[model samples]
Target: MSFDEDNSPFGAGVPSDVYQTSIREPVSLEVPEDVNPEAVQPNTSIENESPVNTPPNGPPLADWSSGISIIEAGKSTEGASRGYIAYTIKLGENTVRRRYSEFESLRSILSQIFPLLLIPPIPGKSFNLKLLATPPPNGVDTETKLVEQRKKMLQLFLKECLKMEQVRDTQVFHRFLDPNSNFNEDLRTGEITDLPLNPLCSNPFNGLDTYKNILYSYLPPEVHTTSMDLESLHLQQEDNTKQTSLYEYISLYTHIISSADLSFSHDFDKANKKVSTTARKLTDYYTQCGNSFNSFSLSEPGTELSLLLERIGTSYDQVYLIEEGFIEFIEKRFNDYWKFYLQCFGTIRDVLAFRELKGRQCEYIRSSLASKETAWQAFQKSDDESQRLTQAIRKSEGVASKHRLLLEPSLDVRFVPITVPNPPSKKKGAFSYSLSAFSKLKSTIADVITLQPELSREEQTAQLQTQINVLRQCLILAESDISKMDEFINEQFHLYHDEKLVFMRGLLREYCRHLVEVNEKCAEVWLETKAEIEGLGL
Candidate 1:
C-alpha cells in the first residue's frame, strides 16, 4: 500500500519507459492551433479543447493557488419555513452558496458524465441515522459541529476534484462554482442526460454521440458477471515475466487497495479512538487539578504559598487549554483525514469496476460474434445441402418426363377393365365417434387459419449473415473501446498512485507537524511553570 520508491506496489524494477510506451496519448485538453480563441465562446463544444472557462489568450486551466473552498456554512433562511444548512463555496473570485444535496447532485452529474473517471466522494448526510433522529440535549452544538465537519470535507472534495485534470476542466465543475449558474437546471438538460443509461456499452470519450456510432449501439446492454468474477478469471493470466492486461492490472490494484483500506481502517480507527479518549481524559484531569490548586490558593490568601498555588493552577489551566485544542485538531485532522481516505478508496474501487465492466462488454461482444459466426456457418451448410437436393430432384423429374414422352410416341395404349372393391363397414363405438368429430373440428380450424410461411433457406441464411455482420461490427467497436479504455485506465492508474504517494506524504508530514507543535507548546507551558516555582525558591 505504501508507494515509497523502494517498496512501490507497481514494479520498482520495471522501467518507467515500459509504462510510458504502453499508454496511448491522452485526450488533449488544449485548444486547436487553427481555432480562434477569441471566437470560441464559453459554451462552445470542440474536440480536444479544454472546457474550463478561460481568457482568450490563455489555455483553460484550474487555479489551484486560489483553490475551491467551502468558506462558510449556516442555516438557510431563504425559501422555506423549515431551514436547512447551506454551504458557501469560494473558488478564486467567484463565490456560490449550495446545500449538501446540491453538492451530492454535482458529484452525481460529474460521475455520470465521466463515468470512467474517478470522481471525488463527498461527505454523507448522516453518519449515524439513529443519532440524527434522536438529537442530544445540546443538539444545536451537535448541529454546529456537523456543519463544520461538512464544510471541511466539502472543501476537500472540491480540492480533490480540482486536482484531477479531467474533472477540473469540465464545464460542470466550473458551473458548480459559478454564483449565478443554476446547477440543477444544467443537470436537467445536460450532457449527462444525453449519455446512454449504461455507460459501459458506449464510447467513454464521446458518449453523447454513441447513438451515431452503430457499433456502440450493438454492444450488450450490461455485463452479466461482477467485477470480482472478472478479476478471478484473469488472475491466472498474471505473471512476472509478461505485462498484464489493463483489466488484470486494475484487478490487482483494486485488491491491493481493498486490503490497504481494511488494514488502515482497523489500525487508524483504533489509534484515533485511543488518542481522542486520552486527550479528553487529560483535559478533564487538568481541569480537576486546576480547580484543586485554585481552591488551595483561596484558602491560603496573602501568602507566597498562595501565589505559588495560583501559579500552579494557571499552569494546569494552560495545559487544559492545550489538551482541548489537541482534541479539536485530532477530530478535524485525523478523523476527517481517515474518512476522506476511505472515500478515496471507494472512488478508486468504482473506477476499477467501470474498467471491469468495459472489459466484460468487450468479452460479451466477442463471444456473441463467435456464436453468430458459428450459426452463419451452420446456415450456409444447411442452405448448400438444400440447393443440392433441389437440383437433384429437378434433374430426376426432367429425365422421367422425357422417358414417358418418348414411350407414348413409340407405343399404342390398350384399355383394361378392373374389378371395384367394396368399402369396409363402420364401427359404432362412442369413442370412435368422438375422435372422428375432434379430428374434423381440427381440420376445419386448420383450413380457416393461415399459418405464416417459414423462412426459406436463403432467407434464413441472409438473416443470419445480417446478424453476423452486426455482431462483427459490434465486436470491432468493443475491441477498440476496450483498447482505448485500457490506455486511459493505465494512465489514470499511474496518476492515482502518484497522487496517493503525495497524499500519504502530506498526511504524515501534517501529523508530525501537529504533534511537534502540540509537544513544543506543552513543553513551553511546563517550562514557564518550572520557572515560576524557581522564582518562589521552592
Candidate 2:
C-alpha cells in the first residue's frame, strides 16, 4: 500500500508460483454469450488466477521471475475458479491465456528478447513474436508475401475462434469512469464548425487565423481518401491483405486503449473502501522485485492496457470492425476514434524505421555487388526495388518526404518541430493574442491548485476543482482543433514558451481548454478578463 521510492511497482511481474512450464489438460469451460455486465464494471469484477497452486504465500511475485520460462505451448485446461488479484504464468499459446497484463507489460518484457521474436520459435520454447518483423528472403515475389499473409490470417482467425469458444475471461469490473468528452452529433456534421469551447480556444472564433489554419490543414487524410478505388483494395488478395495501413490500424488501437467502460463503478472519493474493493489487488505478489500490489497506472488517463487490446486486437476482421465503429460499445463509448487511432502510431514509426534501414543496407550491398561484378544486373534491379520499398515505407508510415531522414538506418529520439493548427478559424497566420489567453487561464487554475494557508480547507474547494476541470476540458478542445487543422497546414508549428514541453503544449493546451469551458462561471470570468486578449504576446 505504500507508494514510496522503493515500494513503488516501477515494473510489474506475474506471481512467482506462476512459473510452471508444463500443464495437465484440465476440463474445459464454455464461454457464455452474455457475460455478467455488472462484473464488467471497473474494480467490481471478481479476480481470478490461471489455476496455479500457490505455496501458502511463500513470497510475493517478482517483477521478473528468472526461474521460469513459459512453455512453448500450453496444455489446455478448463473449469477453474479461484480469486487472486494477480496473473497466472500462461503455458498455452501466448496469444491465448493472456497473463492479465500481457498486452501492456508483455511488449516491454518481450522486447528484451526482441530481434529474436523475428527468428523462428525455439523447438521447446514458447512462440516468440519475432517472425512478424523478420524480413523476407531475397528474390521473393509479392505473391509469396501474399501467401504468407493469408496463412497468418487463417491461423490467427482460427485461434480467435477457439479463444471465443473456450477462454471464459473472469468478468472483472473496471470501475466506471465519467468521460470529459462531448460528442455533439451536429457539430461533428457541419462545415467550418467550431471547436468545443475549452480554455485554449475560449473562443477559437476569437480571430486567430494562425490557429485556424493549423486546424484546416490537420484534417485526417482518410476523410479525403474517398477518391481511392475501394474495389481495388482486395482484402482477400495476398499482397493486398499483406499490405497494411499503419495509420488506420494504430489510431484504432489508441482509442480502444484509451477507453474504459464509462460505466465502471468508480470510487472517486478515497474513503469508499467498503464497496467491494476486491479487484486488481495484485501488487502484493510482485513486492519482492520492488513492485506494487496492483497493476493499475493510477494516474491520468486511468485505463488498463488490457482493455485497449480488447479493442481492435490483431485479429484481422475484428480490428477493422472496431476501427469502423462496428462494435456498438466502442462506437458509443469512444465516439471519436482518436484514442484507438494512436495505438498503432508507435508501430507505424517502427515499420518506417525498419524500411529505412533496409534501404541503406541494400544500397551498400548493391554498390559493393556491382563493383565486384557479382550478378550486376540482378543487383541493379534489387537496388531499385529497395529504393521503391523505402519510398513506400516512408509514405505509408505518415512521414513527409522532406523529413524522410528521420527514418534513417539508425533510430534516435530526435527533437523535431511539428506544425500545429492556428487556433482561429479561416486564417493562415500565427496569433499570439489567442494563445496568450490560454496561458492566462492556465495561470488562473494553477493558482487555485496551489496551497493557500488561509483557505487550505476552503468551502469553495469543490468549486475550485470544478474550475480546474473546466480549464482542462478547454485544453482538450484546443488540441482536437489542432488535430483537425492538420490537413489545412503546410508545415508544423514549433510552439515552446518554456523551451521544453514543446511537444507537450498540445496536451497542456487541451487540458487548459477543457478546464476553462466546463464551468459557466469560470468561462464567464475568462471571457471578462481575456476579452481584450491583445497588446500582449499570445
Candidate 3:
C-alpha cells in the first residue's frame, strides 16, 4: 500500500467487479457459545444501493442504520476457527455486510477529517492471548467473549461518529455505513469526499490562530467583549495558579521515578557483584582446604586426620555449591529481571504521567475560558454603569447637584496630579468654582473615562483572550496526543504481555537447567566420596 502526503491510504483499489453495492434484508447467523463472532469471516457479498436524501438547506442525509449478527463459523485467515459477525450496515434503503476492519477504516478517515477530536480508541484486531491459549473445552466461550467485546467497540466507533455533525452528515460516512460500499477502495482511489465544514469550525489544525478563533466562535455574543474588570482578572489569576499544581505533580513524579530507576539499578548491580565475588572467594577457600588434606600421610593417626579433613572439605564444598547457587539464581537472575522490570515501570509511569499531563492541560483550558468569560461579563457590567452615570449627568442639562454628579455614581475614584488655575479674584481659603465647573468635570471625566484603569483593563482582557485561545489549542492538542498514546499502547499491548510470557518461559527453562545441573553435581560428588573411602580401606 502507498500513502499520500496526509498519510491517507492509497493502493490497489478494490477490483471493479467488487464495486457493486449490496442491498438485502438483515441476515442473522447464530454464533456458537465457544466461538467469537469477531474471530473471522469470509468476504461474502450482500450488495445493494439506495438514493441519497438531500435536505433543502443542509447537507444530504443518508438513511443509514446498522445491525450485527453472527455469521458462519470458519477458519479466520489467522488460522483460528471462530465465528464471524455479519455486521449489517444500512445506507439509505440498502444493507450489506462488513468486517470490523471496515469500521476501523471509517474511523481512521474521520480522524483525518477532524484532527482535533479524540477519536475513541478501537479494539485491536488481533486475537487476545487468553483466547489463543484456551483449552478446547473452554476455548469457544473465550472466543465468544472476545467477539462480544469487538462488537461493542465497533458500535462505539459508529456512535462517536454520529456524535460529530461533521462526520455524521458526510456522504463518505454514509458510504462507509453502507455495507455494500467498499469504503477502503474509495479511499485508495481518492474518491472519498468530506462534507462541508461547519461555519463556526475553522480548520483547527491549520494554525494556532485558527484554532483560537474556532474556540471564540463557540462563545455567546453577550459575554464576548474584549474588556475585563480588575476583580475578574484577579479571580482568573487564581485559577491560573491552580492549573500549575497538576504540572508540578507530574514533573515531580517523572523526576523521582526516573532518578530512582537509575539509582536502584546501580545498587542492584553492586549487590550482584558482591554476591558473585563472595561465591568466587568461597570456592577458592574450599579448593585450598582440599589441597591441605592431600598432604596428610597414610599412618593410622594421619589417615584418621586426613579422613576427618576430607569430610570437612566435602561439607565445605556443599557450602561452596550453595554460594554458587546464590550467585546464579538470586544474583544473576534478578539482575536480568530488574532490567525488564525497570522498563515496565518506566512504561507504566510514563503512561500515567502523560495522562495526568493531559488532564492538567485540559484544566488550564477550561479555567482560562471561564476566566475570560467572567472578565468579559464584569467589564460589560462596569461599562454599563459608567454609561448610565454619564446619561444621568447629560439628562440633568447642567442643573445636577455637585454631590450627585461626583458622589451618587458611587464609582471607585482615584486622585491624580492636575494643574489648577489660580482664582482671578484672589479668593481666600478654598477657591471654589460654580456649577459650570462641574460641567467641565463631567466632560473631563467622560474624556478620560478612567484612563489608566481602562487601559489596564483592556490589556488584561486582551491577554486573557489570547491565553484562552492558546489554551484551547492546547486542549485539542492534548486530545490528539493522548489518543496517539492510547493507540501506541494498544499496538504494543500484545508485545507487552508477551514480555511476561517470555519471562515465564525463561524462568521455567532456568529451573529445569538448575535441577539437571544439581542432580549431575550431586552424583559426581557422591562418586568421588565413595572412591576416596574405598582407597582409604575404611
lDDT digits (tens) for residues 1-538 of candidate 1:
1122211112231122211112232221111223332332221121334445652333343655346677788767576566677789865566789987778767765665566777778888775322433456767677667778888998888888877776766766666776777776665554545555555545565455454554554566555553244443232223432236555566667686777677666875677678789879989999999999999999999999999999999999998998888888778786787668667766766665566566666676667668767877887787689789999999999999999888885443664567689789786899999999999999988865544333444555566666666666556565555555556666777777777657866886786687678779988998988987898887
- Whole-model Cα lDDT per candidate? 0.65, 0.28, 0.47
Summarize candidate 3's per-residue lDDT along 1-538 as a digit string, tens digits. 2434222434332221111122323212112233322322221111112233342332334232233233332223332356444455433444556666666666555544444343445556665533534437757767765665555555545654565445555556666655455666766554342211221122222211232222323321111122212122111223554335333434454564576576666774566566568657867886676566544433335456667566656755675675577556653455444443444444434334223333333444556557666877787788799889989878786666655677675545585568899768855443356556788889999778766876877776565555555544544544454444334333333444465447645765775576467557756776777677677676
Please report, as a residue range, the 10-residue window in candidate 1 with the lowest summed lDDT. Answer: 13-22
The residue-by-residue lDDT of candidate 2 on 430-502, one tens digit each, is 5777688889999998887775833653433333333333323323333443332221111111111122124
Instruction: Assess candidate 2 and give its lDDT.
Output: 0.28
Q: Rank the candidates by lDDT, best first.
A: 1, 3, 2
Decide which is better by lDDT, 1 or 2.
Answer: 1
TM-score against truth, every candidate: 0.76, 0.16, 0.34
Instruction: Count the clashes in each prediction.
Output: 0, 99, 10
* Candidate 3 displacement at residue 242 in angstroms: 29
Error of 3 at 423 (Å): 14
